[model samples]
Each structure stands twice: as C-alpha cells, then as structure tokens.
Target: MPLLEISGLTQRFGGLQALTDFSCRLEEGELVGLIGPNGAGKTTVFNIVSGFYKPSAGQVVFAGRETNGLKPHRITALGMARTFQNIRLWHDMTVLDNVRLARSAWLGYGLWSAVLRTPGYFRAEKAIEKRARDVLEMMALTHYADEFPKNLPYGLQRRVELARALAGNPRLLLLDEPAAGLNSADADDLIRLIRWLHDEFKLTIWMIEHQMKVVMSLCQRLTVIDFGRVIASGLPQEVRNSPEVIKAYLGDDTL
Candidate 1:
C-alpha cells in the first residue's frame, strides 16, 4: 500500500487558489521530490499533508487513515513528522536539549511527576536522553550536542533540525527545502545524510527542494508543480527535460 495518498485536494485563500485538485501518492520507503518555481504552492501542499492547513476539498489519507482536518499534533502522533523551510530550533537551547524536546512527545510521564522528579520521571528522562543521543549520532551531530543552535554553523543547524524530527520516530518524513541555504559541500552532505537516513530508519521521505542537484541526486521520483498544479511527475531526468518545467522556472527569474 502507498504510504501516503492525496486525491482532489484543493485550498483557497480568498479569491486566490493556492492549490487546486492536487493529488499525489508515495509508496513505502520511497524518496520523492516536490519541485516547482516560487509561488507554485509546493509548501501549501506540504501544509495540507502535515495538517497545518485544511484542504478546501478532498482527502489526505496517510497510512490508510484519513488525515484531513486533523490538528498538527494529531497528525504527528500518526507517525508523520516534518521540518520547516526555516530552521525551527530553539536558538537558546543546547542541541541535545532541542532534540530531547522532540522525544518528549513519546515519553511516558505526567506534568506532576516531571515537576516533582519522581522515580518514573527520572527513568523516562533517561530513556529520552538516550534516544535523543542516538538521533544526534545518526545525524553526525553528537560532537556538537552540547553547543547552542547559534553556535553551530548553518549546515549543522539544519542537521540539528533533522535530528529533532527523527527523534519523533516518524514513519514518514517531510522536509521543506532541507538544502535551502547551503554551500555545495554542505548540500552534498545533506543529500548523503538524507539517503542514509531513509535506508537506516526504513523511512518514506517526501521533500520540497529547489536545489536541482540535491533533488536530482537524492530522489527516486520527482513531482513538479506550477501555478498550484502538477506540471510533471516522473523520473528525475524526465522531469528535468520537460518543457513545461523549464518554462515554469524560466518564467520566474527568481527561481
């Protein structure tokens, strides 16, 4: 079965249609790319799937469960996790603390127990720390776990976001422009890490990436959207050669 399925999804903001009848599917353990020019509604689609925005019409079935209109937290509890376009780390917290916060969702402790530091709370905290440590190591950020987000380089900060998302134990991961502001070397590392995580964690990944290099190299399938609709969907090379995709990007000089 497909890990994700979207059919006839639409969203409108006033008179402007942000997404119109957008539909797509992702299979188990698949790594797919969502690419489009600026204002193509790529992020809008992500928002709908991640439960940040409700679709005006249609269904978002994830893991065979209808997810439309679900709150973001409820969607997350269903084994879906996402990273934002902008880094959302707690700038004041240490890297370990930031990721530990993500693991808190699964920690079995109540507010009173945590505040009182009961034996159960201590055990949960320890287990959370261990899981957070494992995630940091997986992302190769173990050495910098003690550093604050502001102290790390931009590339490492992005990795920290990935670590936090993974800390949630998601079956499906959505990344919005994971390589947005990185140098060539950093982008390359990000691509490798994404591929590595998919295999190691048995994850299905769906990402919105404008970096052609990263998208082409990392994704097994590609979906291109323009003007809030799918323009092309196929293998990377096929989508890259598509005239509509070329014009979509070419028409917008800023893309």
Candidate 2:
C-alpha cells in the first residue's frame, strides 16, 4: 500500500473553496514535489494532511489508517512531521532544547515521574538529549546547538526546523516552501542535505517548493495543482512539458 493516500480532499471556507477533489498518493521513500501558482491551495493540502485543518470531504489514509479527525500532535506521534513555510522555532530557547523538546513528546513519562525525579524520567531525559545532539550533528548544526535560533543564518535556521521535525523519528516528512528564502547556493546545499537525509533516515518526503531548480533536481515525480485541482502529475520531465501545466504555473521561461 502507498504510505499516504489522499482521496477526494475538499475544503471550503464559507463560499470560497480552497481545495476541491484533490487527490494523490505517495509511496514509501519517494521524494515528490507539489507545485502550483499562488492561491492554488498547495499548502492547504499540507494543512489537511498534517492535521491543521479537517477536510470538508475525503479521507487521509496514512499507513493504512484513516486520520481525518486526529489532532496535529496525535498525527506527529503517528509517524508524520512537518516544517512550515516560515521558521517557527522558539526565539528564546536554545537550539538543542528546541529539538530535545520535540523528542520529549514521545518520551511517555508521566508528569508525576518528571516532578518526582524518577529514574525513568532521568533516563528518558538523557535519551532525548542524546537524540537531539545526534540529529544536530547530522544536520551539521552541532556548533550552534547552544545558540539561539535568532542568532543563526536563515538557511541554518531552516535546518534547525528540519532537525526538530526529525527528532520525533517520523516516517513521513512534509515540508512547505522550504526554499522560499534561500539563494541558489543555499538552495543547492539544502537539496543535497535533503537527499542525504532521505537516504540515511529512510524517509518519505513530500514538499511544496517554488524554486524550479530545486524541484527539478531533487524530486523524482511532480504533481501540479491549480485552482485547487490537479492539472498535471508524472515524471519531472513529463510534467514540465505538459501544455496545461505550462499555462497554469510553470510558464514559458521555466524548465
């Protein structure tokens, strides 16, 4: 079975329908791209899948179970995690603490155990710290682990967000506009890091990226949506050449 199955997803805000009959499937370990013009409801799909919004109609079958009414934290505990278009790290927290907090969500230690300073609580705390440190090292952010996120560069901050998401050990990762503020060099580096993470962690990734160069170089398949409906989906080259896709978003200049 596909890792994620989204069928006939529709969402409406009063009279404005943000998404209508949107559907797609992602297999295990596939790196797929979702692209569209502004207001095409690409992020809406992410919101629905990540439990930020409940769809008006349709089903989100993840790992063979329906996730329609589950909360975001519940979904994260179910092996799905996501990053936002903008960095959402806590400004006052250290980088290590930010990631360690994510892992703590699944630590399963009760409040009494934490407050009483039980051995299990201490062990869990130690494990969370080690996991956070390992993830930071993997992202090459060990040097900045003790620094505040506000002190880091934009690209490095983005990596921190990814590290926090990975701290939960998710099987599926949803990235929204990860390259939005990056330059060519930084975007290229992100692409390589994403590929490495995908292979190293055995993750299934679905991302919404406006940078054509990043999408073209990284995604094995492409899905294009416009006006909240799918217009094209296939191999990167095939989707790139579709006349409907060109007219809808890519335009004549895009490769």
Candidate 3:
C-alpha cells in the first residue's frame, strides 16, 4: 500500500472552488514534488492532507487507514508531520523548547503526573529533551539552543521548523515550499540538506516548491497543477519540458 494516498479531493469555500477532484499518492521512501503557479491550490492540498481542513469530497488514507476528519494532532500521532511556508515558531520560547514541544504527543503522562512531577513524567521529559538536543546537534543548530527563534536569521529559523518536524519521528513528511524566500546560496544548501535527510532518514517526502532548481535537484517525480487541476505528472526532466507545464508557469519570472 502507498504510505499516503489522497483520492478525488474536492474543496469549496462558499463559492470559490479551490480544489477540484484533486488526487495524488506517495510511495514509501520517495521524494515527490508538487509545482504550480501562484494560487494553483498547492497549499490547500497540503492543508487538507495535514488535517487543517476537511475536504468536501474524498478520502485521505495514510498507512492504510482512513483519516477524513481526524484532528491534526491525531494525524501527527499517526506518524505524519509537516512544515509551513512561513515560519511558525513560538516567539516567546527558546529554540530548544520549540523543538522539544513537538515530542509532547509521546509524553505518555497525564495531568496528575505532570502536576506531581512523577517518575514517568520526569523520564518522558528527559527523553524529549535528549531527542531535541540530538536533533539540534544533527542539524547543526546546537549553538542557538538557548536563543529565541524570533532572534535568529530567516534561514536558521527555517532550520528550526524543520528540526521540530523531524523530532516527531514521522514516516511521512510534508514540506510547503521549503525553499521559499531563500537566496541562491541558501537555496542550494537547502537542496543538499533535503536530499541528505531523505536518504539518511528514509522518509517519504512530498513538497510544494516553486523554485525549479530546488525541485530539479531533489525530486525524482514532479506533479504540476494549474487552476485547481493537474496538468502533468511525470519525471522531473519530462515535466520541465512539457508544453502544458511550461504554459502554466509561463509569465512567472521566478522560474
């Protein structure tokens, strides 16, 4: 079975049909890319799959289970994690706290245990801390552990969000424009980092990225969308040369 499968998804907000009969699937340990022009409903698909929105029609089957209206937290518990295009860090907390909190779903302690500071609570807390620190070390963000995410540069803040998602130990990772708002140098670094993480962790990654260089360097397959419908789906090189795909991104100077 596919690790994640979204079938015949249709979403409508009042009268605006953001997505129409959209469908896609991700196999285990594959790196897939979803590319399109602005307002092509790419982010809407991610939001639905990640449980932020309940689609008007269709099913989201992850790991062979149906997850139509499940809450986002429940989806996270099912080994799915995602990052946003914009940084969504906690400005009040330290970087370590931001990453450590992602592991809260596995604490396995009740309110009474937390209030009384029981052994189980302590152990879980310690484990979460160690996991956070280890992930930070692995991602080379150890030096900023004590600092606030709001105080870091944009690139490092993006790394913090990625680290938080990884701390969840996910089987499926959804990245919404991971290379957005990055310079040429930083974009290259992001491409290499994403490639390394995919191979090292054996993760099933699906990302929505507009930067052709980033997607071409990292994705094995590409899915193109225009006006809430798929225009082309094929290998990266083929999709780039597809007439329909080129037309979809025609006037965009960013490509």
All predictions: root-mean-square deviation over Cα? 2.3, 2.3, 2.4
Error of 2 at 26 (Å): 0.5
* Candidate ordering by TM-score (highest first): 3, 2, 1
Estimate, for each residue in 45-116, the C-alpha lDDT of model 3 and write its tens digit: 999999999999988999999999999999999999999998899989999999999997787788999999
Model 1 stretches astray by more than 4 angstroms:
252-255
lDDT of 2 at 92: 92
- Relative to the unseen true structure, what is the C-alpha lDDT of residue 123 in candidate 1, on a scale of 0 to 100? 92
TM-score to true structure, per model: 0.95, 0.96, 0.97
Model 1: per-residue lDDT, tens digit, 137-245?
8788899999999988888899999999999999999999999999999998898899899888889999999898999899999999988999999999999998888
lDDT of 2 by residue, 25-79 (tens): 9999999999999999999999999999999999999988899999888888889
Q: Residue 137: error of model 2 in Å?
A: 0.7
Error of 3 at 162 (Å): 0.2
What clash count does candidate 2 reach?
Answer: 0
Residue ranges of candidate 3 with Cα displaced over 4 Å: 251-255
lDDT for 242 (candidate 2): 92
Please estimate how well model 3 matches the true structure, expressed as its whole-model Cα lDDT.
Answer: 0.93
RMSD of 3: 2.4
